[model samples]
Target: MTATAIVLLVATALSSLVPVIVRRRLRSTLVVDAVTTAVMVGFAATAAALAADAAPARGVGVVVVACAAMIAAVGGGGYVVRLVLWAGGADTRERARDSATGDGEHVPDAESESGTEAEAGPLRGGRVIGYLERAAVAATLLAGWPEGLAVILAVKSLARYPELRAPHAGEQFIMGTFASVLWATAMAGVGFLITH
Candidate 1:
């Protein structure tokens, strides 16, 4: 790798670390804190890839088109997987333990406290939206948007604070690992396309 590539790689790695460090230091959720880091890593990876590739400008154009197509396919695939998972009755958030208290119980409905019947959740709609969200997220990596993608993931991680806060250490580690790998792939993918 060239000096610039090395620098970009280092920068991407460091960016990925920022959210985890911030969350840990703040005693807060890893999800939110790490979003920005992931996005930056993606961007850095793209830049590094572009720098490393000796392709001519015309070749760059072709790469761009190819990368876009690949990203779309990956994003679509992720959505399809999510949809299938949803159709199979896979979501179990209702059974998930409350992260805050480790209480294996659902929070009482707000309407019940108001002496009214509880409302139904939009579970199906939520599942569809979740798939769309993942598609968008995964697509960002495949597109020439690794940095932006990382940021998006970091934001998601932050938003998912409720899901992760007070998680078992093993759970948190697993999540971190997954996030790292995903972001790294995005960076590497975009970079490879840009450079080649």
Candidate 2:
């Protein structure tokens, strides 16, 4: 492999490890935020540097690698955001437990009003949704379709609108979506820089 490819590979590997470390360490929010920002900036800078000297023959491979790296980066980056929020006293576990019990002051059980047992837990499938969402955002941005982001957001918002009516749902949605989208954007921006 070329030196540029080797460097990119190493950088991507390290970036992928960052979120895992942060999550395990339970670092302060400020620290986690700083680390996450640094990782994204590092990826962008690396991409830009690679682009500057990339040869025509290597373009396709580099683009593929960059896209893969960006996807991994977005996934890890979202975890980093969650770690930060948890560090900042988000109480996600407690919230989950409360939601499951239908006693959460913030998340109302949909069946509770009907005098039935709480059958459903807090919204299921969020993690998969987040992965898909970030992937779509990154892919759209990298494809030179910035306008597609709005559609993605609109669709996500519309789908989550009912849940948003819950007391803390809006706050959670805003924070999670902002972090997920921002991370995806940064990753795709890096890919764009590398490809162009």
Best by TM-score: 2
Q: Which candidate number maximizes lDDT?
A: 2
State the lDDT of candidate 2 residue by residue for 134-178, as single tens digits: 888887887779999999999999999887776566766777777
Which pairs clash inside model 2? none
Residue-level error in angstroms, candidate 2, position 105: 25
RMSD of each: 15.0, 7.8
TM-score of 1: 0.30
Q: The CA-based lDDT of model 2 is what?
A: 0.61
Superposed model 1: Cα runs more than 4 Å off: 18-20, 30-34, 45-49, 52-184, 190-196
For residue 67, model 2's alpha carbon misses the true position, in angstroms, by 3.3
- How much lDDT does each candidate structure score? 0.43, 0.61
